[model samples]
Target chain A: MRTAEALRMAVEALRVNRLRSMLTMLGVIIGVLSVVILVAIGTGAKNAVEKEIAGLGSNIILVVPGQVGLGAAPTQSRLDLSDVAYVRRVVGDPSKVTVAVNSGEPVRVGRVEVFATLTGTDENMPHVFDRPLRRGRYLTGTDVDTRRRVVILGSEVAAKLFGDVDPIGRQVTIAGVRFRVIGVYETVGSTFGVARDQEVHLPVTTAQRLIGLPRINGIAVGASGPDEIEPLRQRVVAALAARYPDETFSAVTQTQLLGTIGTVLGMLTGVLAAIAGISLLVGGVGVSNIMLVSVRERTKEIGLRKALGARGRDILGQFLIEAVLLTTIGGVIGILTGVGGALLIQAVSPVPASITWWSIVLAFGVSAAVGVFFGVAPARRAARLDPVVALRTD
Target chain B: MSHDERAGRRDDERAEASAEPGAAGAPAFEAIGLTRSYRLDGGVQVDALRGADLRIGQGEFAAIVGPSGSGKSTLMHLLGCLDRPTSGTLLVNGVDVATLDDARLADLRNRTIGFVFQSFHLLPRTSALDNVALPLVYRGAPRAVRRERARAALEAVGLGHRLTHRPSQMSGGEQQRVAIARALVGDPRVLLADEPTGNLDSRNGEEVMGLLERLNEGGVAVVLVTHDADVAARARRQIRVRDGRIERDT
Candidate 1:
């Protein structure tokens, strides 16, 4: 039989029972939708993390005083301000790295008190974190050497403490000591539940003097290139170990941080995909069951076609194509719904969701595979039917 | 019931059998020692056709008559290529049917034979034209050709204007005519009808019989299987079977 004829017959057969066919397709739609949406969510998070890490200079590394643990933040610093000179001089190629130290405290500006992470660094701070000043000037190297009592408020902190009023050249009290705000840093939006725009940058010498601490919480370093990041990190680690003795400090590069985050995201996507796959499996079974019933019901029609010269292969192809058509259409609907759902979530919520070309292709291919896999039994049964007995069936 | 009336009817049937239109050809199918057996549910073996022998020629109107369980239906199935024989030398258009594989047999059915079932067997929820066009579809004809040939066949059956009528909407006589049209659409060498009028009234039954007679006159060999003596009498030649064997052929 011609393929076109067989397809027409299969379409007619399906059309005769449209309601049943649609109900059967529902299973497949849900399966595809979940897979698309869940994969999108996973991809979205991965992209978001990558973008953030990239923004913070993927070549950057942080040397802090604590062992790394899940969700663990380091509490105190035992390495002092004098160690900074050792890190710059002892570390390989000082021209390839930019180093800064940071710590935070609540400070009062006028009558408003803003909770902020105070970053104490010299001129390289803006380049290290890519936070260029929006107003006034960044601190000069001379300011750090002179221990100038000047600060740069983060965009959000400036907004809260000064409202619409100018904060530059104004004094803010930190631990009963006043520092002049010479500039405000550019706005960095909130991401991953943390707001980078709320911090205040200051000269390292001034911050140390105000806090009455010669030690600093952490040191952040940016390398000139990706090739330099790892080597720069190793030098920082070596320099810290020599000074701190018992390995009191730990250094983590952005690449290593991204690696950890990627692993977690990969596992998360896999789990979500498996959960979605279960629904797809159930949908395939539903298709199989319905096809079996359809074959049984059309036994006489099969006989008539056989007697009219339809070979077993014709019968098999017809049923198989019918099954495939049902699942493929369901897959198409799923792809649309899943992509739409991901975009919808992204639009309404802070959650990041992404849809990829591979996901659509994968979903469609799986649905077709499901059709062929599940259609085999019923199609075989149809092909193997005896025309005489089939015709004799009422 | 009179002997004279019976003698006159026999003579008339003999004349009709010889006078059948376009009857000058080799047999469409010839069966020699054809046999079929059934393995019952309890493993009890029963023979449906026991070395049955008969010959049906082209453009001839022949009827096979038998009581229930007499195996005339089994012979029809074997002749129609719906079933393989248990054992026999059955030739369809000079090719041994038993030697043909399933695909070859199916091809033979599609090209050389057409069938009309008792229930009409017209697919439900379809236009009459589509029902007639189905056999040609299996033949893999182009869609336009299929529709054109189907339309002509329906016209030949005097259903030219009822092209869109579905089986459920047509009368029993009309449905049977549509089946006949379907059978004729393939332009097969032989047409087979099994109890073609089993569900119709006497008037409709005769109308269907008349249509079959006309198709036979138009050079399509037709074979009718029936239990009704009146239905059987319409055929030019009658073959009677009993207990899985041919009792008489005339």
Candidate 2:
């Protein structure tokens, strides 16, 4: 028979047993659904991490003072401002280094107060950490050298103390020393939910003199570019060892800080996909089982068709097409469900999920392939049925 | 029947007559020294048909009558190309069917012969139109053409108004008529029916027998298998079998 006619017949036959066909397709449905949900989440989280890493390149590194043991935490100030030159000397690149000191205490601005993290950084702070100023001037080299009293507020801190008014030239007191507000950092929010938007930045020496933080706490080192991070880190570490001679320190890069989340999500997606594949296998077996039962139920019908001039190949084509058609329908349902489920997740929670067209195509392809693979034996059995005996079946 | 219906049947007969080589006097189907045997569960062998010789001509209504185990069904099977002979050859529509492969034999059966079983094996839950058009479906005919032909065949069998009726909704005689329509939709040269009226009451059985007679009268050969004396008497010729071979042919 013509293939079009055979396909129509297969569809009609499946429609005659709609409930059974749907039950048989359930396994494929669940398999495709899980694959979509898990893979979408995996790809979405990976993209989110990559976007974060793009905003901050691999060249950004943080150096902490001494490695503290037990419950004691080593303060970043133990790494002094002198280490900036030491780093520039050994790395042979002064422009590629950014050094900073820090302290945090609630400072009053005419009775309006907010508990804010206070940072002491210099001219290169804006460029090194990629934080841009919303208005006015940043801390200049002259400001740090003269120990001038100037401070910059984060967007959140400015909004809290000044309430939308311009804060430049206004004074906020810290430990009884008045400093004029020079600039506010642009709204960069937070990294992984740490509140960077509530910080107050001051000149390194001013913070030392006013806040009683006498020396630099930490040095942030920048490579020439992202590609130079590892080599620069090695040279800086050797320089630090040469200077301190006995104290141990810690250096961390952007990649090491964010890779773990992506790794865990990726492994989770892979493991879940394998489990879904096993469920799909079970669904395939369900299709095979139902097809075998259909063959048995329609034995006399098969015999009649055979006697009416249908060949073995014709019978085989009928059953195989029926199996594939049902599974493809299941696959389409699965794609829609996965997309909807992902959108629902993105709406309610922080877990990321993304569905792509290629994944849909692959899921459909796998389900259809499973249908055919499992459908072979049953179809073959039906095709090889004895016309005489099949007619005698019912 | 309408004149157009008679003309259509005659046109098919004329077409078949011209297509078949040396078909003027040749039997529509023939079997010479045919034998079929198979082993039982315990390796005991049984012969269903042994060296049975038969010939059927165009437009001949021939009946084979025998007791329950007399091998008449085996003879019908061999003649219809549903099974092969073990040691002898059978010719169908002037071709040696035994020498042909499985696919060609299927094609020959599709185009050259139609079968009506004792049980009227119409597919349940399908319309009579679909059931009747099944043979043409096997022939891969276009949908409209197959439907038209099947409709004509159903009308010829006097079931024109029952086109959409499913088999379960039809009476025994009507279902048998639908089966006969399915058989004739391909316009095969021979009709092989196994106890076509066996399951119906006397009234319906006679009606089905009359339908077969009319089809045979329309220039298609008919071969009927039955043990009923009255059913066998309707045919112009009868072959009686006993002990795996023909006991008499008259």
Candidate 3:
């Protein structure tokens, strides 16, 4: 029989049992939908992270003491203030380099106490980190040069310590030492669930003196351009290596951070998509089971068609086409629902979700392939049925 | 029948005659010592047909009558090429069944034979027109041509106006007529009816019998299987089967 004729016959057969056909296709629908939706959410999260990292500025390098990466063991900080000056000299721009020494401290403002991350840095904090002050003056060269007891409050920290009150001139006690707030930072949102808004910054010299720690945690440097970032990172690493030849340092550019993050996120998305594909496989099995039942129910019809001169291959083509039609239709419906669900998530929630065209195409292709893979057994069974026995069935 | 119906039947016969190879002297079917057997699940073998010889000619109306389990249906199946005999030479339309593969045998069945079953075997949810067009679908006929042929065939069985009626919506007699129309739509030389009127009331049975007789008069050979003696008496030839053998042929 011609393929078109077989298709028409299959359409007729499926239409005869419309409810059963729809129910059979539900498994594939759910499978494809979950696959598309999950992959979309994963891809969206990956894109969001990439955007967030990019937002931090590209022409920068982050240098942390000790080797920090996969499989690296924790080590004590050997970095000191001299390393910062060395890096400054290496970069040839002292204004573009800064160092941060961080400690968690409880701050008291008229008995309104809150725990906040206290990071101490030089006067070039805003220039190096690209932070803008909302009020008052940022730390000047004189503050760090003289170890002045002055602090800059993050937006959240300002709100907590002095709610509705102008906090620029307010005095807050940190680590049992009183410091006047000289600046309030404009709000910078959280990255990777770590809030930047709840931090208070002071001059590194005053923080070292107040906390009794003379060592810094990490260094931040702003490169003049994207092209200088990599070479500048290597120079800083070499300079630090020269200062502490026995200790290791990690100098990482923003692009390297983004690439590592992208690879991990890509693998995570693929794994999630694969896990969702199992349900699709189960759905294909459902299709096969339903096809078997349909074949059994239509045994007499098979006999009649055979008697009417339908060849074995003709019967096979008929049932196989029917199965494929069932799944392809389900796949189309799934793609629509998955796209809608992803967009709905994007609209209503903070959990990022965006559909990818490849996921849609892949879901569709797998659903159809599921049909072909699972359809063969039942179709072959129908083809191999003896007409005499089938016709004998009531 | 009207004069026009007679002329149309004669035209069909002439078309079939010209299309057939060796048409002048070929018997519709010739079976010699045809035997068939079935193996039970526990390795018991039972003979369904034991060396039955039969010859049916063109334009002849015949009945094979036997009690249940006497293998009359088996004989009908073999004659219709729906089953192969275990150890006999069977010829359908002058071609030996033994020489043809499954596909060629199916093609031969398509071109030369039609079947009407006891249950009327019309697709329950399909329109009469589509059910009749099914055979031509296998024949690879174009849609328009299949529809036109199906319409003509249904009209021949006096059902042209009921083309769109499904089998469930039709009476038993009408469904059987639809089956007959489907059988004839392919323009086969032989029509095989297995208890064609068995499911209908006596009035409807008589109507179906009259219809089959009229179709036979149109130069198509007709073979029927029945247990009813009165039905068998109407045929031009009667073959009695018992113990998987033809006990009498007259």
Candidate 4:
């Protein structure tokens, strides 16, 4: 049969049973919709993590003290001061290292006293973290050497302490020791649940003296280029391994952390998508069932045509085309609904969601394949009918 | 001329026409010792067509008349290339049907035979024009040519004004006329109709019989299978079958 005639007949068949056809297509719609929405959510999470990772300088590495073994309780062992000095000397770059000791202390300004995390480091710390002073100068090496009692407050801490007044030359008390506020840094939003703009900073010697610590707790390192990070980490780990033979210390690269997070998120997305794929399988089965019923209903028609000289392939093509058209239309609707659903969620919730072009193409292709795959048995049945018996049937 | 002489002269002319194609004058159809049997539920073999020998010449209008279950329908099916005889050398238009594959048989049917069923067998959703155009479509005629030929066939059947009507919307007589148009559209060598007027009233039946008479007059070989003696009386010749065998030919 000609393509035009086949298509016309298929369309007529679908029109004659509109309600049943629509009901059959519903399964496909739900299946494609679920796949699209699930994939969109997965894509959104990946984007959010990537953005967060980008916010923290891609080359930045954190070397925290104490080996928190995988699934073990957290332990605190102060970093050796000599080790920090040795790292600075071995790296031959004073501008890249930020040796810092953090103390959780309560500081009072006027009437309100807020508990804030205080880190003491030299001026290079801000550059290493990609953080710059917004108002006044950052803490200097001179302050660190003299153990000056001058403090630099974060944007949020400054706001809580002085409200509308300039805190550049104000006085604050940390653990009952009076300190003069030198400057306030600009806001840096939350990363990994820790808000950078909510902390206070002082000179390294000042924090050590005030907190009664002989050595810093950790050191933050920054490489000049992202390509150098892994090599630098290896070098640092080897150096630390030699110096701290008794205490186990490790160096982790930013790439390793990013990879770990990506793997975890990818696994989660795969699980959700697999559950959604089951609906698609059910939809395919529904299509097969509908096609089987259609073949049964049109048995006489098939017989008549065959007796009139229609080839078996012609009949098969007609039914297959009908099935494919139905599923393709269903796929298009499902894609639109899935994208719309994702947009609705993004509009109402904090969770970000997005639809990718690949998802649309993939869903449509799968649905079409499902239609053809399921349509084969019925088409074959129709083709194999005996014309004489069929013509005799009422 | 006398009736016998006239018949003899026509037979000679038919023989001469058949001789021009090949040394062996090909019979339009030939069944030699054809037999068919069906095994009933009780393990008894019931013969549908047994040792049936028949031959039909080209451009011959013949009728096969019988009561129900007399195997006339089975003979029609075998003659129309719609079924394979269980055991026989059944040849249609010089080709042995038993040796031909399914596809070749379908091709032969499309090229050499057209059938009109008793129930009119029109696709319910199709327009009269589309129903008539179907045979041409199977023949792979171009769309414009198919439409023109279908229109001409509908006009031939006097259904030009009802081209847009579907089978359900049309009267029984009109639907049968459309079926006739569909059968004629392919210009087959033989037109096989089974109980062409079975579903119509007497007046409509007469009209259909008149149409068949007019087609036969145009030199198209027409075969009608009917139990109605009055319907069979209109034919120039009739063959009566009883219990899977031809009881009379006149």
Candidate 5:
């Protein structure tokens, strides 16, 4: 039989049981919807993280005191202020490099107390970290030379400690020592759940003296250009390796960090897509079950058609086309629903959702495949039925 | 040449050879010792047809009259090419059925035969026109051509006005006419009908028999299966079957 006639016949058959057809299509609809929405959300989150990483200033490199990856335990860093100076000498620019020692500390202003991350660094903080003070001045070289008990408050810390009161030139206590808040850095929004606006900065020498720890946790270097970032990192790692042969340093460029995070997020998206695909499989089974029932119910019809001179392949084509038509329609509905759901989630919630073109294509392809895969057995069953037996079935 | 053209040529040669001086060409069906047996559950075999021989020619109105389990229906089925004989030779349109594969048999049936069942066998949800057009669909006829032929057939059966009506919406007589239209739409050389009027009242039965007689007079062979002697008496030929064998032919 011709394809057009077969399709028309299938449409007529399905129309006879409209409610049953719609109900059977529900499985595939939900399956494709979940796959599209879940993959969109995963892709959206990955994009958000990637954007944040890119915004953390260009030509930047991080040097941490650990040999990460391969399930190895991170070693404690013995890197100190001199190593920072050594890196500066290797780069031939003192202002282009800095060291950060992070520790959580409680700051007191009158009776108000706020827990904040305390970072100790040098005068090059603005240049290296892209951090500019909103008021007052950053810690100068004179402050570090004299080990002055001066401090800089992050925007959030400044607001929390001295709300409606100018925090600059005000006294705050840290670890029982009186310090003057010299500056308040401009707001830098949070990323990966770490609030960058809840920090307090002081001189590296003063933090070492106050915390009783002379070792720096990590080093931050700013290169002249993107091309120089990797070379600068290699030189730093080599110089550090030469000085402390027993210590392992993990040097990474910002791009490298972004790439690793991107890979992890991509896998996460793939896993979510796979989990959602199970529903599609179940939907296909529903299609198969319904097709088998339809074939059985139409045994007399099959016999009549065969008696009218329809070939076995004609019967098979009719049923198979019906099955595929059912799934493809469901798949289209699902794609529309998923796109709407993703858009709704993106608009209504903080959870990000980005619909990738490939996900749409994949979802549609799989739904159609579900039809063909599940359709074959029932179509074959219909084709293989003997006209004599089928006609006798009443 | 294509297989169909070659088959047609062979058919012509066989018809020329079988014609006896001034006889009307080849017979529509020729069976010799035809037999069909079925194995029931647990291997109990039943012979549906026990070595029966028959011959039917084109444009002849014939009736096979028998009671239930008499194998008249089996003979009709074999004649329609819906079932194959287990033994012996059966030729349809001058081609040995045993030599044809399933597809070839289907093609032959499509080109040369039509069937009508007792229950009307019209597609329940389809319009009369589409149901009549169904046989042509398997023939790969275009939509316009199928509709035109189906309309002509329905008009011939006195159902041209009810073209769009479904089987469920029509009465038994009208539905039977629709089945007749479907069977006649293909312009088959032979029409095999199993108890064509079994489900209808006397008036409707008379109407169906009259339609079949008219179709046969128009040079389309009509073969009807019935148990009623009154119905069988209307045919030009009567074939009585009993116990899987032909008991009488008049």
Candidate 6:
């Protein structure tokens, strides 16, 4: 028989039994939906993590004084000014290094006093940490050298202390000392629910003098570029080893931490994706079972066709086409459902879910393959039926 | 009718036909020493046809009649290329049945023979028009041409108005008419019908038999298998089977 006519007949057969066709296709729909939604979630989470890592300077490194004991609670490490100076000298480029010192201090703007993190650093601190100044200037080299009590208010702190008014040229008191706000930093949005732009900055010597601390808590350094981070980290480790001969300090690069987090997230996504893939297998088996039943139910019809001169290949083609059409339609519906479901989840929940083009293509391709793989046995059975015997049957 | 008288009459006619010179352009179905057997469950063999020799010409309206289990249906199946006779040389359209392969046999069945069953064997869910068009589809006719031919066949069978009606929606006589249209659609050389009127009322049965007679008059060979003596009387030639062998032929 002509393929077009066979296809029309197959379509008509399916249409005549609407409920049965829909129920059969449901398996494929769920399979494709699960795959698309899970993959979307995985892609979205990976993108979020990459963005967070990029927010921190790609070439930045953190130096913590004294290695903490295994399984111990995190405690502040102490580093002297001599350790920072030694890193700068060993790096051979004063322009590339910025040593930051941070401490918790009570600060006030007019009558509003709040506990704010006080970061004390040199002029290069802004560039090293990728911190952009929104309004006024950052702490200058002259300010650091003269021990001027100047401050840079973070975006949130400026919003809270001054309301709609500009914070530049305003004065804030920290640890009983008043300082002029040189700049109000621009807002950097939250990462993992933590607001980044919510602190105040000061000159390194001023913070130390105000807090009455002989040593700094830690130092933050930046390499020239991403490629130079590891080499620069090694240089800093050697320099710190020489300077603090009696105490041990640990240097952690952002790349190392980002790599570890990325590995863990990837593994988690892979496991979840595998679990979701199980639904596809169930869907394929469902298709196979339905096809087997269809073959049995249509046995007389098949026998009659054979008597009317339909070739075995014709019978095989008709059944196989029916199977493929069912799954393909289901696949399309499933894709729409999965993408819509992901978008709905994103709208209603805090978790990020993103659907990619490749995921859509992959889901469709796999569903088509499942149809063919499951359709083979039933089609072959229909083809191999004996016309003489079939015609003799009722 | 005594079995001896029937057997003696068949032998005398067979001898007279064999004694005459072959007629030019004789009809195709000619059998010599035709025999067929089936093995029962206990390995006892039963002969369904034994030394049954007969000749049917082209464009002949012939009927084979017998009581139930007389092997008339089996003979019809063999004549229609649906089955092969064992240990017999049966020639159809000048081609020896034993010489053809299975695929060739199927091809012959499609091209040379069309069948009408007692139950009307029309696909249940399909419209009469589509059911009629099925044989043409197997013959690889293009869609438009097949539809046109099927419509013409249905019109010939006086069912043109009911082309879109499915078997379930049609009366028994209408369904048989549709089956006849299906058989006619392929323009086969022979129309073989096994008890085509067995399921219908007398009026509908007469209508179906008249339709077959008209088709035969149109120069297509017709072969009928029936138990009704009145139905057998309508054919120009009649063959009666007793047990597994042809008892009389006239």
> How do all the candidates rank in terms of DockQ, highest first?
5, 3, 1, 2, 4, 6
**Tens digits of per-residue lDDT for model 6, A1-394:** 6677777977987797789889888998998899889988887887777677678665888777766334545555567677677777887776667776777777787788777778788887876787788999988999888999899988988887888998889888887778998998888765545456667888888877887775777777778777888887888887888776886777777777667667777777777666666787688788888888888888877877766667778788888888887788889999999999999988998778888898889889888888888888898898777665566777
C-alpha RMSD for every candidate: 8.9, 6.5, 4.7, 7.5, 4.1, 9.8
Which of the predicted structures, 1 or 5, would earn the higher lDDT when compared with the native?
5
Please, what are the lDDT tens digits per residue for candidate 4 over residues B1-250?
Answer: 4435544654574466345433245667788988778778999988999878888777778889988999999999989877778888888777778877877677667767889999999988889998898876665566677789889999999999999999999999999999999989877778999999999999989989999888888867789999999999988889999999988988
Candidates 4 and 5, the one with greater lDDT: 5
Whole-model lDDT values for every prediction:
0.85, 0.83, 0.89, 0.83, 0.89, 0.81
Question: Which candidate achieves the best DockQ against the true structure?
Answer: 5
Cα-lDDT of candidate 5: 0.89
Ranking by TM-score: 5, 3, 1, 4, 2, 6
Q: Can you list the residue pairs that collide in candidate 5?
A: none
Q: Is the docking of candidate 3 incorrect, acceptable, medium or high quality?
A: medium
Over 4 Å off in model 4, which ranges?
A: A64-78, A99-122, A132-218, A246-249, B1-25, B38-46
TM-score of structure candidate 4: 0.85
Residue-by-residue lDDT tens digits, candidate 5, A147-243: 9999999899999999878988899999899999999988976666667789899998999898999998888899999889888889989998898
Consecutive 10-residue window with the lowest summed lDDT within model 3 chain B: B1-10
Q: Which parts of model 5 have CA positions greater than 4 angstroms off?
A: A132-138, A158-171, A182-187, B1-24
Error of 1 at A151 (Å): 4.5
Error of 5 at B164 (Å): 1.3
- Runs in model 2 with CA error above 4 Å? A57-83, A89-96, A99-123, A132-268, B1-25, B39-45
Worst 10 residues of 5 chain B by lDDT: B14-23
Angstrom error of the Cα, residue B18, model 1: value is 26
Candidate 5 DockQ vs. native = 0.68
Residue pairs of candidate 2 with colliding backbone atoms: A76-A217, A77-A217
True contacts kept of 5: 0.67
lDDT of 2 at A309: 90
lDDT for residue A312 in candidate 2, whole number 0-100: 91
Q: Please, what are the lDDT tens digits per residue for candidate 6 over residues B1-250?
A: 4435544654574355335344236565888878779888999998988778888988999999998888888788788776678878887876777987755666567666788988888998889999999877765667677789899999999999998999999999999999999998877778999899999999999999999999998989999999988899999999998787899998
DockQ of each: 0.58, 0.58, 0.66, 0.50, 0.68, 0.33
